[model samples]
Target: MKTGAGIREHGATVIVAALSTLFASTLILGTGVMTAALDPDLIESSGTFRMVLLMVSAVFIVIALYVGAIVTANTFATIIAGRTRTIALLRLVGASSRKVRSRVAGEGLLMGALGAGIGWVLAELLILAAVTWGPGLGWLPAGREYPRFDPLTVGAVGVVALTTWAAAWAGSRRVGSVSPIAATGAAVELRPDAARGRTARTVWSIILIILGAVFLTLGLLLGMLTPLALLVAFFGGLLSFTGIALGAHIIMPPILRLTGTLLGQGPTGRLAAANAVRFPERSARSTIGLVIGVTLVTMFAVALETYGSMTQIAFESDPALAAALAETLAITTAVFTGLVGFSAIIAAVGMVNTLSLSVLQRTRELGLLRALGFTGGQVRRMVIAESCQMTLAALGFGLLLGVFYGWVAAQSLLGSQAGFAPPTIPWLVVSGIVVFGFILAVSAAVAPARRAIRVSPVAALAVD
Candidate 1:
């Protein structure tokens, strides 16, 4: 790669690392605040709401961490592979694959460590904001104390950074195996043995899906609402994600191609269109994370909306119940919303990771175009465009699903006799979700795009 190209790619890598750090840190800080808020005396008399919120928020954090790690790792792997020809050329010219791998790993580690630090600071701010927002909304009980900074948050963030770095290294392991021939423009090797496992996977996936459906149905039917039921819901949702991803693997390509024909023309549009059908597993994995977030958020949204009205009615039924019910309801609602947001954040993180990975995998293809005269900026734009397309498409579908689920939940909780239209969708809420999704998607694409820009045309062309 030329000096200019190398600079561009490195820049993209930096951006990606920075964005990941910001999100991960914020996620941790929020978790801490949510944890403190779970205290009954601090938030309310009944801590159930706070407890639920904390659990949900924790789930969100977990999702975010998982997605972030995957994306970071994939980005490195792809860059190495994308520059396969380059790596191979170097190898052909006596550059060791081990050296190439180590350099990439070191770069990834640097980013992870730095990002983790920034994330910790951001997390602190998020926690404070959450606490302030909660009490301002009359959600907290009187005299409930606000949250403060803790060493644990910093410690946790550090751990996350290290873990992500390790994961990135793991993802980049394939660099050592890239044939010098690959750098010389040879096609990547395919593994028939891995492909052979698909049939068994499909069958097992189907079974899990059935099992998940059963659990979800039973949990809903028995009205036996408990943490256990929530766990069941989590499992059900997870299995469903895997099933859907598998299904999409088999189903999306033809559909995406057909959709692309209807959508328009150009590499950007075509790429977007093609992507919808390509890599069904990755796309599905991304969607699955979002689905979990949507499910949790939607469930709480419906539940709290119903709970508020019910509590108000109970207050009217007996003035004595007013203060207690209101206090309980307020705290619960606040916690629920906060937690659901956390879940959504988690989903967003997952999407970001998947998108990043997607870009990284195409490093070689991207490099070839650069070799053919595409600018770094163009490569970057392509990566961003792809990420945006996926995110927006998923968001549109997810929102529709969320609305439908919300409506059903409202009906069930309110009962048929309770005549009322569903609550209006607040612009703030809609805007927040959309904005959040867009930002995360863009952030996810940044690193891979940067990496693509840095490839030397000669190296890219000679990649083997």
Candidate 2:
């Protein structure tokens, strides 16, 4: 009974993780295919800073999604390792490792199949709807909505399923290592590896950071971003963040103290700052995904801004439509910005929760605080504060980039009108978007923080 329970638990994790990964990947891939088909020129020759930003951001979105999926798969693999004893017991009781592996793999395959089917059905429904509405709308391209299913999509789904199963199979090596006597004992403890990486890893990290910054800068400057350049920048930025985290680990204490001076923070804020600054690996991984997501969100903001500004220019030339331009631009920006921003928020929230889950799982010590008058509300508030701080920092960087890109795009469109004059921003509009994002981030943090608070004090003290 226990063995079945353990299998079921790990299996569920694998399935959920796999489904998420596949869905994200499909979106990325499908978007690319659609863009290439719809806007070949934009994908090719038009090398503007904003265009480069769009292309690079799209590529990064795909990379981040795939990387996240792999990480989830790895975690699922590790969890399966935790159940090695159960596997060994089954092996000793006349099951082959191959058979045990099959069961694990089969569970993932089943989930993958279901997820892929659902995705396909959704795609087909969308395609059908597009086809049906295409002519009546007059806004859509003729027959453009008819989405044909390619064998490649099916192959891609198969690859996702296979990759997931392979991860489980590889992790099952721990099963072979387990003693059959594990059936009578507690699960073996696997210590977290020490904070050590090789010289090669450090060198690679530095190289990647440098290269990523260069490609990202160049892509923005040249306005002609290729997929290759975006891929390099994506991986490079990821490695760079890893290096930053490692370096931060050494400097965090002093840095935290210095930052506290700037904030003039109270005890609660200070603690939050210390917690985030002190833990380099946690902070880096937690925020890295957000950085990627926010970077894309920011770039998309610039693209939409540029597009709207140009559309407004065209509208301004039309004396009859001049009055309508503001309303149209307002509506378009609202819709596009909301879509792009919400996607980033989802990614950011996921990353934040991933880190929060790890923290809550490890820090049973915090449960004692819940007993010491730290209401669940207070605890939740603290966790959210950390997320909000990181998000705001990201938002600042994004806004700066957006300003630059928006200016360049505006100049390109309204060449003569563009001068040394300072660009006027729609402050109220920008503020509304920022406020909406903050509200969403805060709302998302609530459930996880509450879960942390609810852990019993007994559980807190029991941690090693």
Candidate 3:
């Protein structure tokens, strides 16, 4: 029965998973090719460079998978919300919630496998093309041949598939809360009160945040002795960020309300603000991806800037060492930025998918609004306003988190060498982030707004 929904419904999920795997595999293979081209004998002479390359590739792959998982989980959650009535009917007909959830998760596993397979094939073909013709085209060194296949590619595919399956299972958790009695009512999302009542999640979120703070502080103190303190800070950042994601519904509404005021008190603006606050879970899911992307970009920028400041102070007496440090910082910044771009793309796709699904599910409500004398332009403005509001809130929150995390990272890593220093704000990156948010807000809203306004009042009202 679920398969009858057709591939179009799951296209977003597949695209996200496929892109993620493709990026990971490409990085792994590309890194090997580049290493070979640059230093074919380095592996035989010294394993240190090889290990560094491997670690760099691993960092990129991990980031890609993390972004993919969050996007996948959010997509599945939105899909399940739309299937509330159908799921309730199954429960009414004697299907246990666990059984239903398992089925959904099984579907996710199949989809993940399909996406991973497609990505693997594409990655291989891409590398083959690059290896065969890159040297001839001067894209590679003139006298070197690069290996087109890596056994690691297979591992990348498997990892992505498993991650997607896990995300799907986590997303389908809401299935357990759907009572059989709900089958008799019109399809609807969880109400604000119900969303707020998840006591266990709230408790866990607070616990993680507190523990993460302690670890981050400890990482700073321990950093005075060894650079390995970064490992501790890394876990702290992960735990705290996960807590933030888990508690987004509780954390985002007030920010949304505050940002909504910037949209003015016009009717369309008010409607948009109300809609966002009315569905805290949906709003949080929609904006969390953007938050992550913005946060990473800001964190890296601030961290690198702070590191540069500390290094300049520490190495002022050694011109050659300072010059080399500057070059290394430039290369590191470029690499991290490129890797973060993949995450941003994934986040953008998720936002578009979420917005479109929200509109689809609210068809009846849209129709009622149209019938009550709202113009199509007004509807469009309302959606765009909502998008802008969410983006604004995410931007503000991400900047704060980014600066704090970035400062912690730099201080933890370099406190012993140069002592504590103030975080250097990268105004350029912040400006770029603001501009990107504006563009994203408008672009993400276009299709969803168009769909919302196209709903025929009479026909939409007749839908269940």
Candidate 4:
């Protein structure tokens, strides 16, 4: 009767799902209302202003979709992996594979409904907070009234709910594929075959790369900085980032081990490194969301800087309009960048889930290390090293991809109008994110490390 309770036990997935939906839905509703308030007819009368607004809105939506999909899929996958035992138990007790899939889907649908509702409420509160406090904080211009509740909000919630359900369903596909025998083994047969076809994956990666390049090239052909052109460019960048991410997954095993080697001087590093690549699929799940998020972050940061500099040069004669335009663009840039960055928070949540499970799964191994005279401090360091290696590797690759995309955006958008603004590196912000990321990585390990530490070495070694 209660076989489906495994997913329910993990509140983290539910929470992340809710937040993902809320972030996207709220932005959608807010934008629609705001746009409705600013009649398109009037904005259309102004040449590029409407385009700028539309392009910004489109960017937010794209980030939301990308981040939401990755985050939701990872979260649900974590839930299913953790519940492999329950699934196997159900199978042994006569539950059909179809039934197992149904249970998982049902859980997803329930969570989706609940998450969407909560997201809607959160979005409402966010909009309310903005309306009440935005002007006071100088984030909103004076006399811009908050738009009233729009029916589109409901549609936004529905869209997110559907997205959550799809992600959950997709995540659970392998759940039913596991044989009842695996329940005793504490491992899911993630490696489906004795060997995988490298050719198929390679071909897929190549196709995506070509597709992304086409999008980017098309963006350039569309126009410079126009709404249509930037929208096209954003998609191009997104596709390219996705292609790179897939390629990264294929190479992560080597990269992780190499980075792990650099993380420290001895056996500890090797252990941590081996743990990372021990399950490349698992590691990929943990990092892909952040990879996408950070790549977008870098791309937009450079694009905005380039765009702002061009605006300065283009409108040098009229200081008033120039100042107003510059100010508006800056605000828009910060906001969209923030929206894109939210993807990383979800990734961080995935890290928490993944690392916690890693610790739980390795209880016996950690105990043996402790029994071998490894101090509690050393135990802590080992986990911390693993976290750092993962975080740094993900961010490093993301940074390079972002830089490349940002450069492309700046050149295509501003190249003809003005010579490319020297690559606008938002060093302070990037540095801040790196610091925050390390702190988060360290934080994720604390609970697991403490849990691992509390058990007597004998008991830990005895844990099944």
| Stretches of model 3 off by over 4 angstroms after superposition | 1-8, 40-43, 46-48
Ranking by lDDT: 3, 4, 1, 2
- The TM-score between candidate 2 and the true structure equals 0.58
Colliding pairs, model 2: 47-223, 48-223
- lDDT (10s digit) by residue, model 1, range 279-359: 554454445455445545655565566545644553576776766776786687677577467546645654665555555
Tens digit per residue, CA lDDT, model 3, 1-464:
44634463476778887998899889888877877777555657435655687898888778778878898888888888888888999998999999999988887878888899899999999999998889899899877767888999999888888888899899889999898877765546766898899899988999899889989989999878777888899899999998998988899999999999998889999999999899889998889988888888889889998988888888989989998998999898878877887787888788778877777778788889999999999988988999999999999999999999998899889888888789988898889989988899899888877976787899879766
Q: What is the lDDT of residue 34 in candidate 4?
A: 59
Cα error, residue 85 of model 3, in Å, equals: 1.0
Question: Best lDDT goes to which candidate?
Answer: 3
Best by TM-score: 3
Candidate 4 stretches greater than 4 Å from native: 1-9, 32-58, 128-148, 189-202, 217-232, 310-325, 371-373, 419-422, 461-464
Question: How many residue pairs clash (N, CA or C atoms closer than 3 angstroms) in each of the candidate models, in the order given?
Answer: 21, 2, 0, 0
Indicate the residue-level lDDT of 260 in model 2.
39
lDDT (10s digit) by residue, model 2, range 1-464: 35754443444334434444444444444443354345445645433533554554555434443443433343444444345557767867888767776776676566555555555555555555645675578645454433445454465556555655564565344455566767654334333132233345456656665765665464433333222333433444455444543343232334334443443376557666666555444444355445444544554555455545655565566766755766776686675565455445445544544444544444454676666776666666667776666556545544554555444444333433322223445565457547755675576466667766667767765643
Regions more than 4 Å wrong, model 1:
1-60, 73-77, 86-110, 121-151, 169-180, 186-207, 224-228, 242-262, 265-272, 275-303, 306-389, 400-464
Name the 10 consecutive residues with the lowest summed lDDT in model 1. 187-196
TM-score of each: 0.60, 0.58, 0.95, 0.83
Candidate closer to the true structure by lDDT (higher is better), 1 or 4: 4
